[model samples]
Target: MTSIWDPIRIGRMALAHRFAMAPMTRSRAQADGAPGPLAAEYYAQRAGFGLIITEGVQPSDDGQGYLNTPGIYTEAHVAGWRRVTDAVHARGGHLFMQLMHAGRMAHPDNTPHHRQPVAPSAIAPGQTMFTAAGLQEIPEPRALSTDEVEATVRDFVHAARQAIAAGADGVEIHAANGYLIQQFFASNANRRTDRYGGPIENRMRFAIEVARAVSEAIGPERTGLRISPGSTLGGIDEGPEGPALYRRLVPALAELDLAYLHVAQGGNEALLGEIRRLWPNALLVARGGRPLERAAADVEAGLADVAPVARWALANPDFVERYRRGAPLNEADPATFYGGGAHGYTDYPTFGRALVAA
Candidate 1:
């Protein structure tokens, strides 16, 4: 049986282990959406994983949904991220900047210039988002015209380019987690009658176009995507037809031959296996709340190429070595998970270093 510490080949790079750091929003960046001084140290401390997916970063101001989340659209943002990537690479780690457009999941108070949120449709999620002024109710989003929709695709392309300029190893387009792309897939949030709405094919067209644009901008080998087929966060409901919709989307994405496909599924072994079958010849990453044992089983069974653990990676900087030695793992602090300083982000001690302190 292949262990989690086994070396694996993902994309164009050979990873030292199978464990990956799943992207989680830390909300520690500067108010201008640029990474702060501690960003590099935070990532550098957890460079043991085979790959690290950074937090959801907006591709444009319209994509800013949460307060203090980072961005890669501007030159300064690019420079800030370059420092982060440089630090991670110095530790022999690979990083991918997640290009996330929040779509309707935005509060004007959270963004610079307080721009209104936009989506495939004008409908709102009837939810609230964290802002500098506290949690504010999400306002109605403006519907994007066809031309504007195309422009959004271009925005993703530009963001991917910026990520490359920022010294990132690659880019992961965020199409999951109840964000803008997934919002279009949900029947409740998307009520448009245009090419971006209605049946699954039409709704999926926008996502495919966006991915194609990014893949074209950067080589397909350096581009990846994340998806959650049945997620209903932020007042989204794709209905009972959710699974079928993803059935089609997977093959379409596979056709592009992008770097890999990272799937976030809670359980659904059958679904994971189905996606693995459809996405043949591409690297598959399965990320959910599964335990290490289950994740290893998935990888051993060829259901996934890698298993990503978010909170585990956050709390255990030496997660790979701990897993290898069967050492006791440290519990993560929930309070400091978001919008915190270096306490929880970079303070996790490695097993060897912790033993030395002991």
Candidate 2:
């Protein structure tokens, strides 16, 4: 049986266990899009995980969606993240920074410059996003020109290099959750007739180019990509061709021999099985809303190389220790899941501390 505590290796990075902390958007950055002061302590607290994937970090100023989300495109951002990586490394933890480009999902009110968000087409997602004034409807985004699209790919490459400079072990491209990359994939969001929007191959061009550029800038062994096929989040409509699209996308990514492929499972066992078969190496599955036991079963059954957990990792800093000891876990409070101070972010008590108090 493959225990969750068993050591594993993904590409060039060696992990102490078969479990990882999934990338989650916490909206805890500073006003300037730099990581908050408590970011180091917050991540260091959860160093017990085999790998710690940081929250969604924008690749450029215009990529920001929610208020106070971090960015890796600036010097200050790199400095702030250096502290986080240093803290995690001191405790023998590996870290991967997730690079996200929000595209049409962004609200101008949430950005410091208040610039209009850009996407593959000039369509709005018909969804609401949290801003300084609270939840507001997303506005129609500006469609990127071919030149601009190329620039955005460069931006991802630059951000990947910055992540490595900031002491991160690798970078996970956030092509999931209806972000910029997914926007190009979904037919409802992308109406362009150009090479970027017509066919499934055209729609996948941006994501593939971005991945290739990032991998070239910072070795393929240090690059990871996260995707959620057929996800309806953020008003995405990939149409019925979603599975076929991923069938083409996954293998192209696999050929790059990237660090790992992180798939956010959406209850499609057949699709997941196909992806697993296509890419037999370094697969990390994120089964949200499922029990840790299921994740464990996945590893034991050789269905997944590792399982990424979000809520449990958030509430239990020493999650692996607690699971090993069979101790009860602290429930994550939804109210404090996003922007907030250390209360719910870093105050979750470890089992040893709880026992000490008892």
Candidate 3:
């Protein structure tokens, strides 16, 4: 049995330990959708994690859903992320940029162009998002045509290339979390009659296409993807055939031989075991809302190759060191979790380093 402290080789990259920092949305980017001023510092502080999967980065203008989130298409974006990558590398840490398209979960007020959001269908997410003014209801999005869908795949490839150019170790396509790709999987969120909707095979097409294109642009060893089975975020439901969909989808993805498969556990243990059996490469499991001990159990039991830590990593920059030392952890402040400067972002003290709490 492999322990969390043991070293592992994931694809082309060899890591010192089996723990990684999960991708998180901090909402601290610049007005132009570039990384925030303190972005490099924030990431480099968590360098001991060995592998650091960054926050979601938009691939195009249409992909932006939240305020001040980073993008990879623009020149400024590449330069901004370059600093982050350089800082992380200096500390002997590897970073993988996660490409995420928000789809219909976006509001006009939060975007740079203020244009209507785009998705597989025209349905709204029935959710309210915090904007510059205040909380506002998300409006219905326009449906994408078949031609537009193909262009979206190209956007992901472009983003992956840009990430490599910026000195990142790799890129992770965000196919989960009720985003654009997952929107096509949800029957309620997607009502199209095209090849992207209706059947399970059709729904999984967009994700497969994006993954294939990205892997071709960058080596398959540098590309990875994240998926959530049976997730209901962004007002989505995969219906009764949800399990069947993944039973087929996971193997189809495995055929691509991606660097790794990240599964965000969504209350499905048996299905998770099935996914472990299907994926031949590295498997990263994020057990959100559960104890860290449980996540470690997955790695020890050979169900997961890596344990991606979230809230605990967010609250403790030297999380690995503290855990090994059996020291106390600082509690994370919920109020400052999103859209903040240095308080909850980079002010987290390491073990025995006295600092004011948020």
Q: Candidates' lDDT values, in order? A: 0.86, 0.91, 0.92
Instruction: In model 1, state the lDDT of residue 213.
Output: 90
**C-alpha TM-scores of all predictions:** 0.96, 0.98, 0.98
Q: Lowest-scoring 10 consecutive residues by lDDT in candidate 1?
A: 280-289
Q: Write the per-residue lDDT of candidate 2 for residues 1-358, one digit (tens) a residue.
A: 7777778888787888898999988889998888999999989988889699999999998888888899999999999999999999999898999999999999999887899999999999999988878889999999999999999999999999999999999999999989999999999999998899989999999999999999999999899999999898889999999999999999999888898999998878899989999995789988878875575877877778898989999899998888887789889999999988998998999998888888
Off by over 4 Å in 2: none
Query: Model 2: how far is 61 from its true place, Å?
Result: 0.8
lDDT of 1 by residue, 1-358 (tens): 7665668776777997777889999889897789978999988888878589999999999888888899999999998999999999999999999999999988888888787889888888889887777778999999888898899999999999999999998999999989999988888888778888999998888889988999988988899999887777878888888888889999999888988998887566677778888986544565656676575766676677787878888899888778878898888999998897888888888887788989
Ranking by lDDT: 3, 2, 1
Clashing pairs in 2: none
Superposed on all Cα atoms, the candidates' RMSDs to the truth, in angstroms, are 1.5, 1.0, 1.5
The alpha-carbon lDDT assigned to residue 307 of candidate 3 equals 92
**Model 3: residues with Cα > 4 Å off, grouped in runs:** 355-358
